[model samples]
Target chain A: MASIDIEAEIRAEPPARAPVQRVTLLAALSWFAAAAILLLWQDLTFQPLVRELALIWGAVGVALVALGLAGSRLGRVGRWTALRAPWLLAIGIGMAVWTVLTAKTGLLPQPFFPTPQALLEVFIYDWPKILHSASFSVWLLAKGFFFGALAGFAIGVGMGWSRAVSYWATPLLRYIGPLPATAWLPLAFFIFPTSGSASVFLIAFSTAFPVAVLTWSGIASVNRDYYEIARTLGASPLFLITRVAIPAALPHVFVGLFMGLSTSFAVLVVAEMLGVEAGLGWYLQWAQGWAAYANMYAALFVMAAMCSGLITLLFRIRDRVLVWQKGVVRW
Target chain B: MVASALKTVPQAAGTEINIQTVSHHFDLEGAPLPVLDDITFDIEPGSFVALLGPSGCGKSTLLRLIAGLDHPAQGQIQVAGEKVADPDPSRILVFQDPTLFPWRNVRANVALGLEAQGTLKSEGHRVDEAIRLVGLTGFDKAYPHQLSGGMAQRVALARALVNRPNVLLLDEPLGKLDSLTRMTMQTELVRLWQQSGLTAVLVTHDVEEALYLAQRVIVFGPRPARIVADLQVDLPYPRHRGDPRLAELRHQALGHLGLDSSW
Candidate 1:
């Protein structure tokens, strides 16, 4: 019988796996191809204007490659690049190629499809107006979101916890919840003193419905065992609701908040178009009337970035509060 | 630290438990299904009693009744001459699953009872002591998911122990653990019971576990559970697992449950 050498086995090193290189190579190739197209391809004879954007794109591609090479020493940033290099590269190249095809080559329609250069020009020239409109929209969104979330949360807990509340609220929710906020525009305008207040109401009404429904469902689905355990620990009904039920239902509450946020943004845009003097929605309509499609596109881009940024902020809050669900949930 | 911390908290003197003609039923699809039928028993203070029975024998239901999680449908249960009305921190039930709040870390989970009672500020030291007692000293910051099965159950034990309950009602607490962990935990349970001087009523289907831990074993029949046999093991503390007396008692308990002793 042969005796196994445990010491030697413990001292031995396992084989090292190779790093992912093919995707990195492909990502680099795509970036280079995009840069080459931007540099060599001439269609509309607009040289100086497109050159600046192309230079920026080319610099980004170079930086990405440099980051990938120095990834071993870069720690988290390097690892993140290694993981997301393919998608990042694809997006960069796809946007560049699409801009070249539509804006320079005129393969797509003009005015409707504004060049990236025109969009940039709009940002440079009309930045002050855009910023003013953005701030106004943000203020409206904040007021509406805060009040809607607060009221919805309270109503949801009540509806879920008490039979009497549910009995009355369920039917009301059923009747009012499914109706779109825009549908209530005519009534809201008459009901509220100002267009701004009417807009706020529309946004709030849209946001509250989803939040209330989700909160009700979330609270209803909390494990009975937790309640029993809390009760055994001498917890009051208030303690049970606040500490036990609320915390347990947080994951569901977050889902509700996310839905509410999206709907609120949609309502905000439409409500702003309802004779509101200042907001991204009002700006978009003004830009469209003047046939400045570049400004419209720029506004759309800003709205997209802002909405996504808000959602990201909410996700960060959820991750911090619901620490127990760390590895279980991911975007 | 353990000794001083233990001394600081008032020791929960075991309270006598009395059940008078207790019966319970569950409403399954609007039809009443009988669970426990006319069960009566008395548990002395500071004694360890094992409720040994077959699966679904309503032993857990009986334990829940004693814990005041539910009221007996027919009869009444009293603890130290006072009628059991609602669940109190004085009587803590440790379920089969560890049931530690996944949101709270080990230390916070242990502190839950005190926090609920609004005495957390004064009795906060007990949480650390309980964690130490359960041998989870280094895992104070660990979440329930981060801990192993045995560790989670240990945290659950610590959570209940922190409250210093006079009556610890265990409903198959070690039923989910691996054999090795279960055996080690059984020893730990006996040690905690001996040290604390609290009345313990354990519900388990494991014959060897009942034989190893309890001074007295109460056996119950299936379905509408009723006490079939009650036997006392006069063996001393730190009883050996391989002792002939334990094997004899195991045989007796198994025979009462209508199972063959020759496994």
Candidate 2:
């Protein structure tokens, strides 16, 4: 009744490759259009809507230039647009320089926060502070994730592997897993200082509990029939866990680990905001107290970039490791 | 339609095994639920026997008893002058479902029993030969999921045969296949039986199939099951469906089962 020709579907292939001319052409047209808009709009008034649009387009031009350069380096374009990187970079620099010149000539009103020169000055002057804060925060996050996820995964596997352990620990862990890390802030303050160690502990406490619970449930749900076959084949309990159970639970474990990573980052930021002296959260609070809104905005941008980049990195690792699930849609 | 028990013909002697007064019961809580009540039968070596019975009639329980998967609450079962205690490689049981490991391919599944017993290297030649014997010549790397029910059952047969078990216990191995596949599998099974000459005890409810495959069909009754009739099919190998002798024997077996009342 279940007649399926899997081979036929699998063996079919699409047609041969097309030229890169179309994509390169589109990129070139977009770059030129962005350049023209910037040159035309540099002298406009600084209305909130128009100013935001200009700033956003200005960033887009810069990004396009970088993308074009990188694509050319990777030999991604046609023969005509092979040298498009220099053209794009020239357009970007020309627009930015023209915008600065127009502002100097009093053609455009002053920016709300800073002139282009002032924004550069802030970036140059505060580079060291921003770098230090980001590095310190990232370090704490990594430390929390490494220790917490490892310990949680171990505990989960152990508890799930044994019925007695599950019976004893499940109740306690269930009660603790849902309690937010912020709820423990007061307790942590009394227990440890607002230093690096407390931040890490807060991050770990928030991340590890949920990760353990997920992992235990994941391992518990592994197919019992696989284990029976293993047992019938004379596999020891340890062998069964290592060979059959773990591989089957790996995708879920990775999901838990990723969730743990994000939670740790979030908890680190909040914990730093409490009283920590050196982190992105601390930097934001420090900037706001002094009414330096630009510095706060910049720190916020850096945090967003870091979180996005780290998530992409995690997904890349997952893709490479779990390549077997690529074509199959199990989840 | 109950024919009196026939004056038993003397069987050619070769390993005259005995299953003495075997009775099995399920002890659920404190109550005794009898499955097979005082089952006494003898299967001579190198003979094809069918334990024919309706569903829930303890045919499989009897087969399991012979396969050493379960113990009788009372009495003794002896094979080749030795008492049965536990499942051994010498006696293999093929279930109604193909219990092949999904992770392993056909050849690996077949070779598992040998590998588990740590005889793979020493018995590699025989494993290959058994795979060839079951007509699964090229399907070495085909996993169980990729196999059809009939093919998977064949792989199970190969697995059982590769171990060179003296007694083969089949618990409705072809029950899951379609009519065409079942017929082909039955033909293939008979061919293999003739070629290998292993003593096989197949449990089935289909009276016609029981007659077609087995040299002797042991009929059983339900509710504390026991043997009710033992019919012999004297027709030779490769028996036809419309063989008049088979038709008469089929009707006799059906009548004994009281299916004539339904018609």
Candidate 3:
């Protein structure tokens, strides 16, 4: 009798929840709405422009459906889509509505708000030039960020670890840290032979200050107990700094890296506008000079994408390196 | 039973500690705050001694001084006939908090001393042995945060033991554990001390704990700590908490602390 009761109780319990497998209805509806808007809207005078817009929308819808099917087969993909599909649908539909309003109905102004199709045209036509400029800008950013982060890390460690270093550097950092990178443009131009080196110097200087300050603070704030433990274990001064202090200060160093990256981008753009002829910032300036608003917008979009992509890459590296801090630190 | 774990490493002769006229003070915003005053004691090699005292009585400060993490303002501490000046792995101090580097795993924490001494390549096996000694063999890869309070304290013990320290100074190492774990660890500590044959000086306020573990108990007076009582316990190993002799020592220790022992 007891065995039967146990069996009945186990049977009565709820089953484990299976992952959602069916295609999301709302996502399908959103795609249909976008398609209808693309096809029914007849205000565009250019047939090729309308065809291009239709083709892009159709491709996106098909890709989303194919991804949803693949997601159902893969558990991780299914989980990702379950979390992100609604937001993706909202963005897709919102953009489709925006395109119809600005390009087809003429509800918003032309030239200032170029059609998405026109922007696509600019992207396709100016691919090589844009790619070349982007690569140059990236090269400049990599060099500046590398040297800047290295110098900052070394100086910051010295300042934090030694009283004499702190005494000397703190005053200098205070005087220079708050000044804009552009303030040194005149000095940088005078010091460097090429405008390229000048631009690199501007970016490097802007990046270095924040990295130095944050690294100093990070090293300073490491718990005194860690040092005590390491010292008792026969650790040398080098071991204490490298093994105990630096690892303890890494989270702070990452924060500095993030700050340095954003500042580098800002300085890079302004430095390019100064005199440099082959970068995204230069492309924007050239477009503005010719009053090619579409090309300027195109360059702006690429810059936004590139910056965000780099930030995401940095975050991925931080997550991998700082895996022990998984639950303790949310970001 | 726990002593079996200690047999993996051959025990070295314990070191003797001689602290003479040791006085220490900290500078608090330019004003001196005395912590220990003319504290003098001798710990024979391989003896288990417990320093029992009230809170804030400079017991931990005394431990730190013996560990050579700090120096006295007035006197000197000699370990194995050598004048103490700086921290050495031979006289390891286990803190109240485990203080394991959160970034490192259990094996790495145990390996720290060897790594610092640049002998990790030759002595790396000691880390694994230490982990096994603390009964944390399976948890060698676990981070400090993943362990319970008792488990973390065990890892800290392993970290100290891996150095094969002659003198183990414990600053209330098990004070943070629950009553049950504390009682268990007290026996474990006694077993390890016996097996390893290392001199240990424990600073704790728990009277029963001191009586159950240490052969000699040194009681301290309030602030500006001074030795008030030094009682010897001639008890057998694997002692029972309910033993009448241990209860008497507990009362005596409490009495020295100026606490009524009526309960």
User: How many clashing pairs per prediction, in order?
Assistant: 0, 0, 0
| Candidate 1 per-residue C-alpha lDDT over B138-189 given as tens digits, one digit per residue, 9 for 90 to 100 | 8999888899999999999998989999999999999999999999999999
Clashing pairs in 3: none
Candidate 1 residues A1-331, lDDT tens each? 0012222222232213323334445566677777667667775745335676667667777777777556434656655666576677678778677777776688877778877777778887899999999989999998988888888888899998999999999999999899998899888989899989988888888888888999999999998888888888889999999988888888888898999999999899988887588899999999988998989999999989889999999989988988898755665
- Candidate 3 matches the true fold with a TM-score of 0.93
For all the candidates, what are their Cα RMSDs to the real structure?
Answer: 6.3, 9.4, 5.5
lDDT of 1 at B22: 95
- From the highest lDDT down, the ranking of the candidates is 3, 1, 2
Model 3 alpha-carbon miss at residue B224, Å: 1.5
Write down the TM-score for model 1: 0.89
Question: For model 2, what is the alpha-carbon lDDT of residue A278?
Answer: 84
Model 2 misplaced stretches (Cα beyond 4 Å): A1-31, A43-161, A181-232, A235-240, A244-265, A268-331, B1-34, B45-47, B61-92, B103-143, B158-167, B191-199, B235-239
Off by over 4 Å in 1: A1-103, A328-331, B1-10, B260-263
DockQ of each: 0.63, 0.15, 0.75
- Candidate 1 vs candidate 2, TM-score winner: 1
By summed lDDT, which 10 consecutive residues of candidate 3 chain A come out lowest?
A6-15
Instruction: Name the runs in model 3 displaced over 4 angstroms.
Output: A1-36, A44-48, A65-71, B1-8, B261-263
lDDT of 2 by residue, A274-324 (tens): 858889999988988887766886788788988787788888888876655
